[model samples]
Target chain A: MPVSIIRPIDIWFAEQIFPHEQRFHAAALRISGSRDEAEELVQEAFARLFELEGWAAIEDPRAYVVRMLRHIAIERLRRRRIVDFRQFADTDHLTLADDAPDQHRIAAGRERLRRASDLIAKLPERCRTVFVRRRIQGESSQEIARDLGISQSTYEKRLARAVELLSRSWQGDEDALPAAAGPANTSRRSGSR
Target chain B: MSIFNEKQRRKRRIAREAATWLARHDSGTIDEERFHAWRGATPEHAIAFARALAVWREAQSKADADTYHLLQSRFTRRRAAAAIGGMGMAGLLTAGAFTSRAYAWDSSHSGVGECKRLILPDGSRAMLNTDSEMQWRFSDDERSLWIVRGEVGLELVRGIPARIHGLDRMASLSHGRFNVRLEGAAMDVTVLSGKASAAPVSAPVVMPGQPALIPIVIASPSEGLLLSAVAPSVRKASPQHLAATIAWQQGEIVFDNEPLQTAVREYNRYLAGKIVIADPDLTGIPVGGRFTSTDPADFLSALELGLGVRATPSNGGYVLTR
Candidate 1:
C-alpha cells in the first residue's frame, strides 16, 4: 500500500491500542501499582510500536505491542524508565485528594506538587525517572520496571528506598506526599507513639 | 551549617550514595548480595536510596514536557555547532563528498559511515550518508521518496516530476512530515509540508503514520513509461522553511543569530572538526551569516567579528580560546 493510505489506518489503530496501553499498566500495577511503573509500561508499549512500518503487515500489532512492551518493561524493571502516563481511574480529573470542593486549595496543592517535583528533578537521569513514575505518578512496580527495562521485584524495593528519604532530600519543600507513608492518620499515630 | 543542616546533609549524603549504588546495580554493575549488604549498612542507607529515587522521578516528570527534548537538544547543539564551524558545508564543498547510500548495491557503501550517491531513474541525484536507508518510488504521476530511516540529500533538476500535495491539503493524506518535492536533483527545496501518501504493497491503504512495510516491487522501472512521467521527488516546506534537509546543498550554512557554540555542530557533521567554547559565558553569544563550510577560519572570523572571541585550532578540531 502507498504511505498515504497507511496513515489514517494508523490513527485508527492508535486509538484502539491506547486502551490496551492502559490495561497493560493496570496489569503491571497488580504487582506494584506505582504510578511511575504503570506509566513506564504504558509508554514502553507505545514506543515499541510507535514506528512500526505497517499496521497490517503484522497480524496483531496491538498484541505484538503489548508483548513487546511487557518484555521490554520486564527488562527495564532491572534498569529504570520504560516510557508514558499511567492512567488511574481519575487521572484526567486533575482534582486534589481532599474532600473539600475548593478548587483554589487543589490548585495550591498542585503547585506544591510541582515544587516537590523540582526537588525530585535533581536526581540522575534514569533513577530520577524511576522515582517519578514510581513515586510522583504512583505507577506500579511492574510498569516502572517495564518502562525502565528492569524487573518488578526490583521496582518495589527501589521505590521503597525512594519513599524512605523524601523528608531530608526535599527538606522543607512540602506539598507532595513522601513515597509510601501510609495515611495521615497512620503517620499521626506513629508520630505520637 | 547549623546542626540541623549538618544532620540533614549527612542523611542526604548517605541517601545519595545508596541511590547511586542502586542505579548502578540496576545497570548490572553490582549484584543483589552487594546491594543487600549496602542496604544493611544503616537504616539511613535505605532512606538515602529512597531520596535518590525521588530525585530520579522528578527528572522524568520534566521529560514529560517533551519526550525527546534531551535527545533533540543534543542533535540541535551538534547541528548548530556544525553550521557555525562552517565545516559541514566546507567538507561537502571541497570533498564534494556524497553522503552515500548503503543500498546493498556496492560493497564499499556498507560501512559504518560510508557515503554513496545514487542517480535516480529520474535525473535527480540522491546522496545518502552512512547508516541511511531510502527507497525510490517510481509510479506514473508521482515519483515518491520514502526515507524510511536516516537522512539523505536530494538534488532536483528542471525536468524531474515529483508531484506535490500541499500542506493545506494534508488533512486528506498521510505520507510524511517534511516532504520536499523539488525539480530533479538541485531544483532547490520548495515544499516541505504534509505527509507521504502512495499505495503500500496492497490492501494497506488505511495504515499510515507508523513506519510502514510493504511487499514493494524490486525491479527498476520498465522502460516505456519513463518519458510520460513528470515527478518532483522532494517536497520542501513553502511558507516557513526549515534548513536541515537543504543545508547539504548550500555550501554556505546560514545561521540567523544562533548561539556561536550551537552553530559549531553544523561543522562537526562533515568533518571530525570539533569546536570547544572554553568560555561558558561566550557559549550563549548570538551568531548570524553564511560561512564557507571548508574552513574554520571563516567561522572563527565570524565569531571574532561578531562576538569578539578568538578561535584556536585544537589538537583535533577547533577551540574558542576562552
Candidate 2:
C-alpha cells in the first residue's frame, strides 16, 4: 500500500515554482535567444533550485527562479569562452516582482479546472474511460478493474498513458502531440499518420 | 542534437515512470519503499512527480454532475464519429457539426448587481463583472472573444491564441490571465499573467506570399494597454492600482484616491439603483477605500462620516450632496 507522506519542498515547488512557468520560459527565451537553449536553461535552473539548501526560506520563489535562470545563462556563456554582451545586457529585467500568492493561486487553479475537462475529453477512448472512472468518478482501482472486466495491471497501464499524455500537453508540448487513438486501433500502430 | 534527443527521451521516460507511480499510489497498491526511492533518486524524478501531481489534482477535482454528463456526451460523440469512418453519413454528420459549431457564438451576460463565472467551450475561464456582456466563438484554428460591455476576468489556457474584440480595437492574447474592461471608446487590458498585444481592428491581415507589418503593443504582468483605434498606449500599473482594478472580481469596488465622481461611476456599474453626485462641487473630492459593489450603504456612510457629504434618497437611487 502507498504511504501518503507529503513533503514540504514538493508542495512548495508545485505551488510556488511551477505556477509561474510562463514567466520563467519567457525570461529564458529572452536570455538564450533559442527555444532549445531556453528549455535547457529553465530545466537546469529547476534542477539547481531543487538542490538549494535555502529553498524553503525563499520569500519570493518566482523572482528567485528568474535569478537562477540568469545565473545559469551567465554560467553557460562564460563556459563557452565567448559571451554576447548584448545578450548579457538583456538579462537585467529578468527579476519579476511578486504578486499576491492567493490571487495567483486562485487564478491558476481556475484555469486548470477549466482546461482539465477538455484535456480529458481528448483522451483516447480506453484511456479516457479508465482515467475518468479512476480520477473523476473517484472509483477504486480494484472496483474499476472489476467493473470494466480488466486486470489491475491493465487499469494501471491505461491510467499511466492518460497521465503521460496530459502531463506533456499541460506543460505546453502541443506541436508534437502523438495522435491519440484507442489501444485496439490499427491506425495508432502505424504512428501519427 | 543526438545528446539533446537522448536527454528528451530520458525526460519522457522519467515522466512515464512518475505517472505509473502516481497511478499506483492513487490505487492504494504502490509499494511504499520503492516509490519513495524512485521519486528521491533524482531531482528530475521529483519534478516529474510534482508535474503529474498537479495535473492529477486538477483532474481529480470534484466536478458538477452537469460537467460530467457534458464530458460523457462529448466522448460518445467523438467515438461515434470515429466508428462511422469514411462513409457518406459520416461526411454529412461531420459537415453538420461543423456548420452548427462554426457559425454559432456562445454569449454570457451579467446583469446589474450580479457576477457570473463561465467556462468557455475551449476550457478558458471568464468571470463577468456586474452589467457585463461577453460573446465568444471558437473553432479549430481560432478562439475569438468579444467584450461587448463592462469588465471580464479571463484565465485562458495554452492553445490557439485568443483574439479579443472590443470597440474598433483588438488584442491577441497567447494564453494568460487578464482583466479586460471596456471604457468609453477604448478597451483597458490589464495583464495579470501571460503576454498580449494590442492593435487596431483595421490592421492589415497577413496575406499569403507577403510580409505583414502591424504595430504590436505587448503588455506583461502588472502592465496595461489603453487600446483605441486612434491611439494605443501601454502603461505600468502599480500593485495597489492593479489590486484595485481586479478587486471587482471579488464583488468589491476599490478606490485608491480616485475622484468621487469616478468612484461613484465605477460603483454604479454594480448597483441596480445607482449613486449620483447631486452636488457638482463634490465631484472632484478624492475618495479611497473598498466597498461592496452591490450595495452603496457603507460607501454612503463612509462619505457622510469622512467627507461630510450627505446622501439623500432619490427616485430609485441615492443622491450625494455636500
Candidate 3:
C-alpha cells in the first residue's frame, strides 16, 4: 500500500493558490478566448509558479499567476498565428470574451455582481467554503469533502444549499438580462470533449 | 406574508430548480435530451434557467475580481514591509520553504480498485489506473516523473520535454500525451499525441548534444526481441489503440473481443473480488463490452445469458463455470 502523507505544501497550496483558481481561470478565459486553452494556460501558469523558488514570497500570487497566464496566452497566440489563422478565429466563440461592454451594461453588471458577492459572503461558513471550492476552485466533490473532513454527500448538500441561497438572493432582481452574449450552455461540454 | 413575498419565494424556488439542473448538467450525470425537454417544459422554466446561468457566470467572474483585489492589497502591505528590509525577507523565505516543500516530488498513488487524476505542479496531467503509484518532479531545466507501479496516462505541456521512468524502461517525451502500462519487467508506451522514445532502464546512457531522434519500440520487450542497436526507440502510436487503452481515464474498460481470462483480469484490477474461470476452456471465450470498471454485475449477467456460464460466490471471490 502507498503511504498517505499530507504534506505542508499541499495545505499551503490548498489555502492560498487553490482558492484563486476561478479568478485565474476567468482571466485566462478572457485572454485566451477558449475554455480548453484557458484551462491549459492556467495549469501551465500554476506549474511554472509552483516551480519558482520564491513563490511564497510573491506579494500577490493570484495577480502574479494571472499575469503569467496572460503572458503564456500571448505567446501561444503568437505561435498559433504562424501555424493557422482559422484556429485563432475559432476563439471568438468564448463565453468570456475580452471585448469591452457598453458603459451602461458594465455599470449594471457590476451592481449585480456586487449583490451576488454579498449573497455568497452571507452563506454559512461551511456552505461558502464548499461552494467556493467546488464551483470556483474547480475541485471535485470528493477532494473538497476530503479536505473539509466531511462526507461527499454532505459536501454536495452544502453546495446545493449555497447555490439555493444565492439564487434566492438574486431572484427578484429586475436587471437580469437574458443571456445574449455567447453559447454558455454547450461551450463547456464541447471544450471538454 | 404579503402576496409580493409569496411571488418572490416562488421565483426563488424556480431559480433553485434551475441551479440544480445546471449543476446536474455540468456534472455529466444528466441526460441532455431530458434536460432540454425540462427546459422547454414551460416558458417560466426556460427564463428561470437563463437567469440562473447568468447569475452563476456573473458571480464566478465577480468572485475572481474580488479575490484578485483582496490578494493585491495583502501583497501591497507585505511589499511595504519587505521594502523596509527588516526581518521580512527571512520570514518570507522561511514561509516559502514551508509552502514549497511538497514540490520536491509530489508523489501520488491510486489504491486498489481506484482510479485517480492528478494535475501536476508543472502544467502536466496524469491519470492513474487501478493500483498505480507515480511521482512528479519539475525543475528549472526539465520536467521529470516516474510511474513506480501499474499504469498512467500522461499529457505533457507543449515545448517542455519530460523524462519518464516506468517499471523497467525510461521514456523521453517532448510535448505529447502518452499512456504507459507496466507489466512485470516490461513496459508498454503508447504515444497518444506527439512523440516519445523508450529504452530499457539498464541500457547505457546515450547523451548526444543535439536533440536525439530515437526509434521507439511500441511492442513490449521480450527476452530475445532485437531492437535497433544504435537508434533509440521512438514512434507515433495508433490513435484507435491509444483511445482504447486510455478509456480507463473515463471510468471505463473497453474490451474488443478479448479473451475471457484477459477481460476478467482487467476487471479484477478495478474490483474488490476477483472473477475466476474454473474451466480452462471457458477462459478462452471471447467477451466484448465497454464496462464501467467498478461494477462487474453487468458483465457477469451478460456471461450468464450469452455464454451460458454460471457464476457462484466463492470464499475467495467468484468462481465461473460452464
Candidate 4:
C-alpha cells in the first residue's frame, strides 16, 4: 500500500479504538503511576498499533490494544529496575535460582525468574501483600490501601522494602528480614544501622 | 578511552542506548537483533540486564500482592456477613470531641447553591447556607459578630458554658449587632439569643422572651421606626428536634419527618453542591434518615426510601424527583 493512501487507515483505526485507548490509558496510570513513563507507555502502545504496517489486520482491536499496552508497561518497568533493587544487592549465587527464583524474577532476560515467586512467598506480610496487588491485579496503590485499611505511602514503602529484600535474597546476602533461614541463616535485620 | 573514563563513558552510552531501545520497543517495535546485541556488549551491559530483570520481578510481585489482598478482603467481608448476617452498620463515633478554638474557621458566603459554616474561637457555632455571608471577631471584653448577608444560626456557647460554672463572668458586646443587607434589599433578624441588638431596626431593643422579625428600612436615615412586634407564639424544640439540630455537630445531618424540600436544603449544607427537588409533590413528602451528609448516596438513599423519588446522575451531580 502507498504511504499516502495508508494514512487515512490510521485515522479510521484510531477512531474505532479511541475509547479503549482512553480506558487503557486511565487504567495503566491507575495501575502504574501518574508519571511521564506511564503516559509514554500508553501513547507508544496506541501509536504502535496505529502506526504498524499490519494495523489493518488486528482481530479484536480492543484486546490487541490491551496486549500491546501491557507489554509496554512490563518492558518499561524492567529497564528501570536498578535503584529499586538496592536492599538485596548481595545474595548467594548457588542459592539464588534454586531458592525458588521463578517466583522472584518474574520476567527478565538473564536472571532466574523461577526464584522470584518463592522469594515473594518468603516475604513479610505487608510487603508481600503490596507486591501481589500492584503487580498481579494491576490495582492502584490507592485502591489497595483503601481495601487494606492503610495509607498509599505505606504500600509504596512495602513494595520498595519487598524489592530491596528480594535483591538481597537473590544475591544471597544474609541480613534481609527472614523468619526461616533468611540470607543463608544470616542474622535477620542485623545490618540495620 | 582511558580505563577510568572508558567504563564510565561506555556505561553512559549503553544506558542511553538501552533507554532509547526500551522507549522504542514500548511503541511495539521488536528490534530483536539490536536488543540481543545490546545485551551482549559489555560488563555494564550485564549491569543493565540485571537492573531490568530486578524491576520486572518487583513489578510482577506488586501485581500479585494487589490481587492477593483484594481476594482476602472480599473473602473476609463475605465470611463475616455470612456468619453474622447483614445489619445496619453505624461506624462508631470514636473520634474524640475537641474544643477546637480556631481564630475563625473558614468565613465564607453561601452561593446560589452553596452552604457553609463559621466556627468561632470561643466554641460557638453558626451555619451559613444559600447565598449568605457572615464574619466574627473576639475582643478582650466581648464577642462581636456580623451577618453580612444570608441566614445564620447561633447557638451561644458562652451563656451555656457560663451557666455550667455559675460564675458572674460576663461576655458582652460593645456594639450589640450590625444587621446589614444595606447594599441590597433589607436586613432581617431573629434573636435565637442570649442578648442581641439589631442596627437600622426598631427601638426597645428586642429581647429573648419572644421571637422578633424586624425589617430594617431606615429610609431617609433619620426617620427609622423599626416596627418590632411579637413574632407569634412559638414552642421550644422538643428533644427530638434539638437532637436533630445538634446531630450535624458530629458530622451527621439528621432529618425526621421533615419535608423533602426542607431535608434537601439541610443536606445541601454540608455538601459541596446542591441537591434540588424539582417536583413540588416530592418537596412536601417527609424524609427521615441519619446520614453522614458528606456522601451523596446517603441523601439519594434517603430520598429513595422516604419519599419514593429516584436519583439519577446528571452532569457532575444528581437530580431527585418522583
DockQ of 1: 0.03
Q: Where does model 1 exceed 4 Å of error? A: A1-193, B1-117, B129-150, B155-245
Top candidate on DockQ is 2
Ranking by lDDT: 2, 3, 4, 1
Off by over 4 Å in 4: A1-193, B1-132, B149-200, B204-234, B305-307
Fnat value of model 2: 0.44
Question: How do the residues B160-230 of candidate 3 rate in per-residue lDDT, one tens digit apiece?
Answer: 67877653345677776677776534345665456665654344456777453443443321101111212
- Residue range A44-126, candidate 3, lDDT tens digits: 77566545777534544555665677677657878663645554454443323432222222233345456666667767788
Q: What is the lDDT of candidate 4?
A: 0.44
lDDT of 2 at B298: 75
Candidate with better DockQ, 1 vs 4:
4
Candidate 2 predicts chain B with a TM-score of: 0.67
Off by over 4 Å in 3: A1-193, B1-103, B200-204, B207-240
RMSD of each: 21.2, 26.2, 26.5, 25.5
Best candidate per lDDT, number? 2
Q: Which ten residues in a row have the lowest lDDT in candidate 4 chain B?
A: B162-171
Q: Please tell me the interface RMSD, in Å, for model 2.
A: 10.1
TM-score of predicted structure 4? 0.28
lDDT, candidate 1, at A62: 48
Candidates 3 and 4: which is better by DockQ?
3
